[model samples]
Target: MMKNIQLKAMGKINLGLDVVRRRPDGYHEVRMVMQTVSLYDKVGITVEDQPGIRITANLSFLPLNENNIVYKAAKLLMDEFSIDQGVSISLEKHIPVAGGMAGGSTDGAAVLYGMNRLFSLGMGQKRLMELGLKLGADVPYCIMRGTALAEGIGEVLTPMPPMPDCWILIARPPFGVSTRFVYENLHLEKIDRHPDIDGIVRAIEDSDLEAMCARLENVLETVTIRKHPQIEEIKNFMRERGAVNALMSGSGPTVFGIFENERECRSAAEAVRERGMARQVYAVKPFNP
Candidate 1:
C-alpha cells in the first residue's frame, strides 16, 4: 500500500503586532507575538503511482496546481532530493482565506512536515523551516508549531512558554483583508504608541492574564480598523459580550475574543453569532505546538 498521512494545519492569531520599519526589500520589519489555535485545516497526503503532483480541496476557489503553497512545498522537497514519487494533497480548509490567519502558510508548513514523515525524507526541522521561509514569512512559525514571539519579517521566532488554559472566540466578517495592501498603506509616523513587547513577554512567563490583556496591542489594528469599521464593531461587541481581551488578529477582518474559560468563550461566540455581526465564529483553544 502507498504511504498516506494526514496532518492538521492550525491557524495563527497575533496577540500583539508592531510594525517597526520598512526594509529595503519592501517587507515591513515587525515584532509580533503569534499563537497557534485549535482551528485548523485538515490536509490528507497520499503517494501516487503517477509522476506528478495532484492537489484537491473542497474550496474550489483555492489554486490546486503549482501555485498552491502545498504544491510548492512538495515541489521544493522533490527538487531537493530528486525524488521520483508523486503525491496527492487534499485540503479541508476551515480557516478563513486571506483573513490574516495564515491559512495558506499553515497548509504549506503541514505539507513540508507531512511529506518529510511520509516520504522519510530525513529533513530536519531546521531545514524544513529554512525551506518554509522561502514559501512565506508565517510558514516558519507554523512549522515551529507553538506560541512564539516573531520578529524581522516574522521569520525570527522565540518559542513562548505555554499559555494559561483559556478559550478563544474568533469571528471573521465576509470579506478578506490584503496583508500587502495593509502594510503598504500603513503610516509609520502616525504610529506614536508602541506595544510593550518586553512587558507582554514577562506577563506570559508569569501567566498573568490581566497583564497580557492590558498589553494586547496591534499597530496594524489602526490601519485595518480604519478601513473596515466592521472589525472595530466586532471587537467592541466581543468586549461587551465578556471577552477579557479582544483584538484583530494579523492584518485582519477577523477579530478574536479571549476568555478566561470555555463557558465564557462559548457563550460569547453564540452571542456574536446570534447578533449576526460576523459571517463565522469559532470557539477554540490555543494550540500548543
Candidate 2:
C-alpha cells in the first residue's frame, strides 16, 4: 500500500438549479446542472500506526473531528471494509467553506477515492459512488467529476456533455449562507421563473456559448439574492465587465461569470478584488480532468 497520496477535491458551480417541488421526506426535489470547476482543495492521506482515523486541517476554524466530512468518510470506509489499518488525513482548504462550493462534499469524495488507492481496497467507481451517497448528496457527483444533471435532492445524476469553451470567474463575498435556511425559506409561489434545463442542454450540445449564457438561471437565486442584494450587484458588475453571462451558484453568496476570454476573466477578477465586491476571487476553467 502507498504510504501517502494527495488528491484534489474539485469545486462545483450550478449552471442551473430549480426546485421541482417539496418532497414528503422534507427534502426538495431538485433539477440542476452541476459542473466541476478548476478551484479545488488539496487533501493528503497517509497510513498511520494507530487503529483509527485522525484528521487535521490548515483552516483554523474547521473541525478535525467527526464534524468534518473527511473524518466521516475515512471512518465509513474503515467500518465498511473491516480494515484495522489506521489513517491520517490532512486538508489544505482552497475552496471556501459553506460558500455553496461543495467544498466539504468534494473533500469527503477525495478521501474515499484516495483511500481506495492508498489501502489497495480494490473498490470500483460504482461502489465508491454508492458509498459517497451516504456521506452527502453532492459526494457521488464529486467522485464522478464532470458535467452532470443532478436531481432528486441532488443525488440522482445523469452525465452531461462538456461545457462550452470559456473562462469561469468566481467571486464569493465575506458572508456565509446557510443551505438549510435558503431551502426552508424558498416559497414556490415567490419564484417567477425556473431555469430552462432543456434549452441549456441544447446549447451545450451545440457548443453555443451565448445560448448557454442566455439560459443560465438558478431558482435558489431568488431566495439568496433577496437576502443578500450584493449577490445581484456582483452579477450586474460582472455582466457589465465583459462577462457574457453571470449567476449565483447553488444557495450562494458566490456569484460566477462566464467570460469568453482569459484577459477579460482575469481583469474581472482583479476588478472585483479592487472594488471589494468579493472576499475571494478566482478566474478558472471547467475541470474536465
Candidate 3:
C-alpha cells in the first residue's frame, strides 16, 4: 500500500517590506517581516507505483505540470532522496495566485514536509529548508512558517515570536503585480525612505498591536499603489471601517487590513466585497504555525 498524507499550505503577509538594494544576481535585496495567515491551500499526496509526478487543482490558473511548484518540490526530493516512487499531488487553493501571499511557495513547502513524514525520508527540517532555498527565496520561510524576519533576497530568515492571533482582511484587485516590475522600477537612490523591520520585530515580541500598527510600513507600497490606485482606496476604506491597521502585502495589487476579531474582519471583508472593486476579499486569521 502506498503512503498518503494531507497538509495545509498556509499563506503569508508582509507586515513590513523594504527593498534595500538590487543585487548583482538581478534579485532585489530586501528586509521584510513576514507573518503566516490562516488562509491556506490544502494539499493531498499519495505515492504511486510509477516514478513520475502528477498535480491537480481547482484553480485553472495554477500550472499542473513541471511548472507547478508542488511538482518541482516533489522532483527535487525524489532526486535528493533517490526515491523511485512517484507522487500524486492535489491542491485545493484558497489563496489567490500571484497575489503576493506566497501561496505557491507554501504549497511547495507543504509537499516537501508531508513527503518527508509519509515516506520516512529522515530529512530533518534544516535539510528540508536548505532544499527549499533552491526552489525559491520565499520557500525557506514557508518551510519555517509562523512569523519571521526575512532579509537578503528573502532567503535569510530569523524566526520570531508569533504575533497575537487577529483577524486578517485581504483584498486583491483584478490584475496581478509583477514582483520583478516593482523591483526594476524602484529608484534605490531616489527612494527617500524605508521601514524599520527591527522595530516591528520588537513590537511583535512585546505583543503590542498598537505599536505594531504605528510601525506597519512597506517601501514597496509606494511603487504598487502608484500602479494600482485601488490598493490605496481599499486601505483607506478598511481603515475607515474599523481596521486597526491596513497596508499592502508584498509587491502587491493585494492590500490587507488587520482587525482585533473575526466580527471586524468579516465586516471589513463584506464592505470591500460589496464595493465590487477587488477580485477577492478574504476574512482570515494569522496562522499559529
Candidate 4:
C-alpha cells in the first residue's frame, strides 16, 4: 500500500523587515518578523515501489523539473535519509508566484515535512529546520510556521506568541518584483528611518492590535517602492478602503493590509481588484502553526 500524505504550504507576510548590513557572503544581515497567513498551497505526496521522484503542479508557470524547489527538497531528503521508495508530489498553488510571500520556499519546506512523515523518517523538527536552511533562508521559518522573529539573513527564528487573531488582506500588483534586484539596489546608508523591530515584537507578545498597526514597517520598501511607486499607491488604496494599517511585505510588489473585520477585508480586496491596482487580493488570517 502506498503511503499518502496531504499538507498545506502556508504563505507568510513580513510585518516588519530591516536590512542590517551587507554580508561578505553576498547575503545581507536582516532583522524581521514574519507571520504565516491562511493563504496556502495544497501539496499531496504518495510513495510508491519505484526509486525515483516525480513532481507535478497545476500552475503552468511552475516548473516540475529539478529547477523546482519542491523537487530539490525531495532529492535532498531521499539522499540524506537513503530512502529507496519513489514519491509522487502534486502541488495546487494558491499563493502567488514570486510575489515575495515565500511561496516556493514554503512548498519546498512542505515536501521535506510531508516526506518525513510519510516515510516514517522520524526526523526531529530541529533536524528538519537545519536541513531547510540549505534550501533557502525563508525555508527555515516556513518549516517553523506561526509567527517568528527572524535575524541573521532570515535563518535564525525565534517563535513568537500568537498575534491577536485578525484579518490580513494581501494585494499583489500585476508585475513581479525580483528580490535580488531590490537587494542590489537597496542603500541602507541612504535609508533615514528603519522599522521598530522591538516594538513590533512587543505588540505581538502583548497582542496589542493598535500598537501593531502603528508599528508595521519594512525598510526594503524604500528601495522597492522607488522602483515601482505603484506599491505605495497600493498601500494607500488599501488603507483608504478601511485597513487600519497597510505595508509592503518583504522585498515587495505585494503589499498587505490589516483589517479588523472580514467584511471590510473583502471589500478592500474587491476595490483593489476593481480599481486595477492589484491583479490578486486575498483576505486572510494569521495561521497559528
Candidate 4 lowest-lDDT run of ten:
1-10
lDDT for 241 in candidate 2 is: 94
TM-score computed on alpha carbons, candidate 1: 0.98
lDDT, model 2, position 224: 91
Off by over 4 Å in 2: none
Write model 4 residue lDDT over 199-286, tens digit each, in one string.
Answer: 9999989999989889999998888898899999999988889998999988888899999999999998988888988887899999
CA error at residue 139 for candidate 4, angstroms = 0.7
Best by TM-score: 2
Flag regions of model 4 displaced more than 4 Å: none
Mind giving the per-residue lDDT tens digits that candidate 1 earns over 1-289?
Answer: 4399989999999889998999888889999989899999999999887878999999989998988999999999889888798999999999988888999999999999998998888889899999999999999999997778999999999999976678889999988899877988899998889988878888889998888888888899888888899888888888887888899999998899889888888988989888888887999999895
Model 2 over residues 1-289: C-alpha lDDT tens digits?
5899988899999999899999888989999889999999999999987898888889899998888999999999999988798999989998888988899999999999999998889999889999999998999999998988899989899898899989999999999899999999999877778899988888888889999999999998888998999999999999999999899998998899999999999999999999999998999999876
Task: Estimate the TM-score of every prediction.
Answer: 0.98, 0.98, 0.97, 0.98
C-alpha lDDT of candidate 2 relative to the true structure: 0.92
lDDT of each: 0.90, 0.92, 0.89, 0.92
Error of 3 at 275 (Å): 0.6
